[model samples]
Target chain A: MFDIVIVGGGGAALVAAIEAATLGKSVLVLSKHYPTQSQTSMAQGGINAALYPPDSCDSHIQDTLKAGVGLAKEAIVQEVCRAAPKAIEWLDSIGMPFSRKGEAIAQRRLGGATYPRACYAQDYTGLKLLHTLYDNAVKLGVALRSRTFLLNIIEEDGVCKGVSVLDMARGKVEQILAKAVILATGGYAKMYGALSTNGFGSFGEGVAAAMRAGAKLSDLEFVQFHPTALKKSSILISEAARGAGARLIDQEGQEIGGELWTRDRLSRAIFEAMEEGREIFLDMRHLGKEFIEKNLPQERKLALLYEGVDPLKEPVPIRPVAHYTMGGIDVDENMQSSIQGLYAVGECTNAKLHGANRLGGNSLLELVVLGKKAAQSAAQMEQAPQQKLFERTKIDTNFIKAVFALPNQIDFWERQEFLSKIMYHNCGIVREEMRLKGVLSVVRQHQKELAFMGVRDKSPLMNKELINFLEYGNMVELAEAVLVGAIQRTESRGAHFRADYPQRDDKKFLAHTMIWKENGVLCADFKPV
Target chain B: MKIKIKRFHPHFEPPSIDMEYEVDNAPTLLDALLQIKRQKDRTLTFDYMCRSGVCGSCAVRVEGKEVLACQHIPKDGEYIEPLSVVDVIRDLSVRLEDALVTLGSSKAYPLDMQKVAMNEEDERLIERQSDCILCSGCLSSCPVYESNEAFLGPFALSRVWRYVADKREQAKKEHIDAVVQNGIWDCTLCGNCTQVCPQGIDPKNDIVMLQSKAVQFGYQNPNLGGFGSFGLEF
Candidate 1:
């Protein structure tokens, strides 16, 4: 058994593996695909660090709290913001190759920041950081098992016992026992499907598995919609482009200002405009070719490739797409979930850092700081002997077989597409009691239909259809939770805007929406911040 | 659009075959592939994550030219197949295990680097090299690695140069030594890797720079003979 098993291959998981290995613990990273091909690579903007003079951590913390709209935990916010500089230093020591201002790391202004505090490496910030972390993990001899899908977290008698995974390459289910397991499995914004700027695997399966293993999840209704994704394809044109002076314009060529506001506000503004039947475009033509080439090269490439519009020559059509989920498995300051020895970090966990909404550039920072923190905490815990296998395993196996044996009467793709459309329309950026209930009923219908779903390809080796079907199951489960949370939280705050209420009701709904399973039935409650 | 896909399964009959389908409303190769998998045959296996070009999971050869399936718009009757350089796991999903191993063996990351101040010029010098997405498109087009598996291909060599040119790195000599054998010298400078790189990283030029650095360190090309034209031994 390994000391720590990380169940994702993104920036958070790699950093955790490096930290655990540095602590001289046996660690293994299980990835559904190669480590580098993760959602973290899609984070093109920079990571936040208050390194520039006169921009203290206090300002950064205040900015973050303001962006979170009164729901961010002060303690966690302070811890993450205060640790930002040292985190950037650690990254630099490992050769992150950050874009440099003379003799120092370059800092840029991201939205929702009080200062130019984000240290970047051109526009490929996340990609470069992820590669550097992967390189360090390899150099430190971290064992990696790619093509392994996390089926469930093994919990016996309310204690963590590692995980059960499907060996995609070998086509079999196997259980791995670890002293501790960290879930760094990323966000679930892709539940919005074609309307989201997330990878295909961002289905929140890890969060679902953790919840099944008796973990509490929180604030799942707070999904941040980025203001400027390429309209044709939901591929994100990084906020760095706007930070570099790209303007948002309406179809009449009139500037719709608030280009540098926090993501929620800008997205709502654009959503309101689009509701009025106006098309929005990101105008970067004034930024000049040299500046675009040097700083925002990836933005230019994405705009040209995806939408067939060169930002240098013309305005690129854009819309607000679901970008980041601010809600996930609820964890304490130590990054431990409700289950013992079950830890979570990164976008997959709602550590109360980004309560209602996440500030720009903070996600990458959280991946490093909290990733290392979770690893250190897990390593220092006393080793627990292996417990007997739980009966839940047998039940889960039967369930899997039942799913495979069901008739293929309903096409999984069609159902998935229909679910995405309804979610985007009824449960997306704007929501109300009637529409949310409408979508929730549809989601419940889909859950009922899951019993009739099956894949035509019985051969399990690298079965993409099987994976899609399973992901659909997970998505349906999470969709119910999201709609329930959205329906329950009757006040408008941060990303969860309620058109019915139309105001932040801090009096009654200031607390977080907590969801968990009790006796195999989903339940929701409120936890005071 | 009509597209043909090369299908293979180790446990299936005949092992390999070409299947064609007419995909409507499919704009990109990835869309067409997914359409076929969803509507025509559920058994078609491939891999993709971020339909955006950032994640490198969707790289395959379309009409014998390596392109990211998500980014490349397909022409009518174009052929899609797995990358020729790697072992196919099933159909279009090539095994990246061997290529990742070559990357690990290169030791391309910064070694024994001190925390030092860096300027914009220094950072810009290595910026292009660091943009590599590790897509293996370079290895797919690399002529030298086609024959010699031991050769450290374009992806790893470019990463090696990324660190060697950085101002913060202190162990440049060690990095040079790491690439001297089967690494930089094995490259043919054929420029195929440069042509196929979607990110525009020029590994061929980076290999030439490594050669110059080696010459500065008083190391001769092992391919060169010891005897001079003047018969200096007399």
Candidate 2:
């Protein structure tokens, strides 16, 4: 059995693999797609670290806490912020050619930063770090198995024995025996469909799988809606644009916020502007074509390729899209889930680093630092007895066949489009009791249709339709969790803004909303902050 | 728009197939491809992830040109084929196992035994070289790889440029040597790879840059003319 099996191949998973491998433990990184394609590579801004002037760990923590709006855990925030500088140093040592100043790596101010602490490698900071870390992990003997999709974790007696993975290449489901399982699967913003800044694989399958294995998820409602996604495809136009002098304008050409507002404020401003029948656009023309072509090349290419707009000559159309999901599998200080030997890090777990909403640069920081902590803790663990007992879940061939042949009445595209419209309009940046309930009712009504969704092609090789159907169903459940949490927390705090209840209520709701399956029905319970 | 994909399974010739259902609003070609799978047939498969172009997973031949499906808009009669010069698995998907093998021989990742640092200004000159997503659009489109399969190809050579341009790397001779072995001289500099790159990365320029770096490193393409004072009077 492998000493550690890491599911997902993003930044956090790579870090965990490296750390685990460093401890003389055999590591396996199972990824749904190639590691380079993971959502971590989509991170355009930069990683946060108080490595330069006007920036300190304490100040960075404070900015993150303020942005989190009362839900950000003090200790966890301290953990990530304290490790930020060292994390940057480690990444640099591993050949992350950070964007530098005179002799030092350059640090710049991102949204919600009190100082210029966000370190970058041009605009593709994540890409630089991800490539280096992936290479280092491979050299360190971390076996990265691509095209392996995790079905579920096999646990018996509160200990994770291993996991069941669908080997896509072999076209068979198989068991992977491991002492520990780490879910580094990223966010579920793609649950919002075309209205999400996430890539296609960002659906939170690991979260759902962990939930099915009796792990509770915390704070699923507070999805961060980034302010500067392209209006057409919801492809992210990075916030770094605003950091480097870009402005948001409503139709008729009036500036909303000129370059330096928090994401929550900007998202609300754009949402309110759109509601007022004003089309939103990101104005970066003043930054000059040379400045853009030099620093923000990724943003320029993304604009020209995806939206067919030139940010240099013309303003790019923009709107808020669901970017990060703060809620995920609940983990402790050690990053261990409720079930023993099961760990989660990165966007897939609620490390409480980003309470209601994450700070601009802290997302990448938390992934690296907390991911390392989890690896060290797991590596230090006394090996659990290799018990023969397992909660074996037999594959029901009849049910599998029945699911394929189900009389799917509703088309998946129409259903997804309808859901995206409902979520984008109703449960989006601004939330209300009536709107959340409306979407919940719609989901409830379509439950049967979802169950009966059928696949026409019977060829089993590379059944993307089956994967889509499964993920779409999970998205519905995960979306329901969001609506449920939104309904539960009747307060405006961080990203969870309720129009009906316009004030932050710390007395009754200054806690993380934990949601899980209780008796096959969704149940929400609050845990004190 | 009727989407046509030349479907191929292992050990069989590709079959022509058109999608059944019509999608109302597909923001990109990827969305349309997904709709074809979801609304029509579950078994019709292709390799895709990160509908965003950054992932490089959804690269395919669209109307005889290599492009990222996620970035391009779908046109009617779109003929989806496995990106050329890669092993075909099934349908539009290609077995990418051997796709990036040339990168290792090119020493794409720095071969530094010790950690090194370079100034940000120095890195800025070659930073664009790092953005090659290895979508293999360049490799698939390159006439060098199409003819001489052993050629180091476009993306890998571009990566060598990314490293050779780096002032931090003390020892880059291995990278230069690897490129020469893989026939750095084999590239035609036709610019097909540059046209096909979704990220706007210029592999042709990078390859030429590597050639310059190779000359600076006391190596010259063996395919070039007589070294004996034939063209130059010293």
Candidate 3:
């Protein structure tokens, strides 16, 4: 039995593990795959912190609240902002090679920052930070159990117990008795098929597990779709590109002006252009060939050296992809969920800071800041008695096999491609009531089709079959929650723009959307932001 | 155009199967596979991303070695299939995700940047290697990875070297000691990582630097050392 069992490995889990170890708690990190594979490694932009002289906690809070379009909780935003600086200092203390502007830490301007307050270690800031944090945490003796997927959270008598983790390497399920648990399993953006830049493991297992364990997931409807992901591949081009003066242009090379415009506006514009038979490219031309050659030389190299395109001369095709999810496991200002001794952080939880749309550098910032808070709180909580309990879940091999044998085994890819097209056409960027309802109906049909998915390989250890099966489940739930939330919200704010509503209606829908799973059915509730 | 793809699976005969594809001028090699899946054989599978190549997905063996299918231009008579050695997922998409496992497993010195003041040169040296996108390209190209599954591949080791070389990062000795085990020592100092690197990061040079740092940390490659030597514990 351990003091804490942290499920999922990402920026939040890594930070929480570090903090827990610092506070002298015996902790185990259960990562479904290797720790760094999480979307945190994919983070290209710098972390947000009010380190610049002109920047203050108040200003940061105000910006976040305004971007959130008034749905952001005042206290949570304030707490995250106050904690932001300390998180930066901690990262700095632990050798985050933040760019320096003559003895002072150099800062870059991202979408939401009023001033240049983004501390970066070049473009691969998240990767560097994650590597640093993982190294530090391991050295401090955080027990990292890689290739361990949590089957379910074990709760007893209304209190949180340990968890049942499937030893993915050995193909055996085991119950880990622990005093507390933290879920940092990342967002559900991948549910939209091709729209997501999320890794396959990013299918919202933790959120589903938490919901299964009677934990309410808040703001499930407010998924933030990033305005730019590379076309076809859906790889995220950091908004830092826009922050560095990249523009949004149409097929005729007409500038949209507000390249750094809120993601909702940009995504809407891009989607509209596509609808009007125009291909959109996040124009990196303005950032200058020299800057692209020097700072983002690899991006140019990736284009020419790999794609054989002279990016300095030609425009790279681009599109808006489902980037980050703003809503997740509901947590308070302290990163504590309603369930005591359980905390959620990073993209896995809705801390109410990014109510609707996330600021550019703020995701990583929230990871370090509120992640530390969650860790500290979990560390301080009284250790519960060990409980030997394992939740029962059976894998139907026959069903899995039958699905694999279906004539349309590989057709799922084509279906997924179709799903992406539909999503981008209907539910993406700008949504209307008619389009949204049509999207839900299509989503249901897709979900039904996915139900017949079969696994070719039935192996228990590190089987892609099982993993894909799990991802399919996550997609179904995520699509339902997003559709429900998008349908229910009935307003325009931040990333959730409804053409039917047409305008930002602060009066009717300034609340958080909470989702719960009961009897295999999804249910929704609202909380005042 | 008639395209030949060399397919390999543990279950298949002769280790590699050469399959032919007919195509038109187009999107990508992956686009060709989708065409084949739609028209000829549905079993043909390969990994891809960003049809543009920024995501580092869709890497596969074209003629002899690993190449990102999205980036590698389609030719009239090209050989395409999954990368060699690693577990095959389907056709061209091998399960090479283990390339990043060492990043989480390695030990490094404490990150007390407040204590260490960095010079511009040191920062430049560290920045040069930190851009690895975790594509399994280097691993697919490495001969060492072909023989030894336990070997920490180029990407992870190069990244470890990236941190160890950083002036601000503490635990330089610790990082050196960390990678010298199953990490850097397992690398045969081949230039494959440098060659296949889409980002142009040289894991060979990074490994050499890591080796130098390991020496500074009073550690030696136990496998390479002639005399009985002791391993340093941080």
Among the numbered candidates, top lDDT falls to 1
- What docking class should model 1 receive? medium
lDDT of 3 by residue, A370-438 (tens): 777788877766777554434432333233344545554444555655765676556667788888888
Model 3 residue A337 lDDT? 73
lDDT of 2 by residue, B125-172 (tens): 667777766688888998879877788898888877777777766667
True contacts kept of each: 0.77, 0.54, 0.20
Residue A411's lDDT within candidate 1 is 83
Q: What is the TM-score of chain A, computed separately for every candidate? A: 0.98, 0.97, 0.92
lDDT of 1 by residue, B112-166 (tens): 8788888888888888898878889889988788999888999999998998998
Clashing pairs in 3: A93-B113, A94-B111, A233-B50, A403-A454, A404-A454, B47-B58, B48-B58, B82-B92, B109-B171
The TM-score leader among the candidates is: 1
Residue pairs in clash, model 1 = none
Candidate that scores best on DockQ:
1
Tens digits of lDDT, candidate 2, A140-213: 65788888777777877677777877766655667787878889989888888889888889889899888877
**Which has the higher DockQ value, candidate number 2 or candidate number 3?**
2
Model 3 misplaced regions, further than 4 Å: A164-177, A301-309, A380-391, A394-415, A445-451, A456-461, B1-114, B133-164, B169-190, B207-234
TM-score of each: 0.97, 0.92, 0.84
Q: Each prediction's Cα lDDT score? A: 0.88, 0.81, 0.72
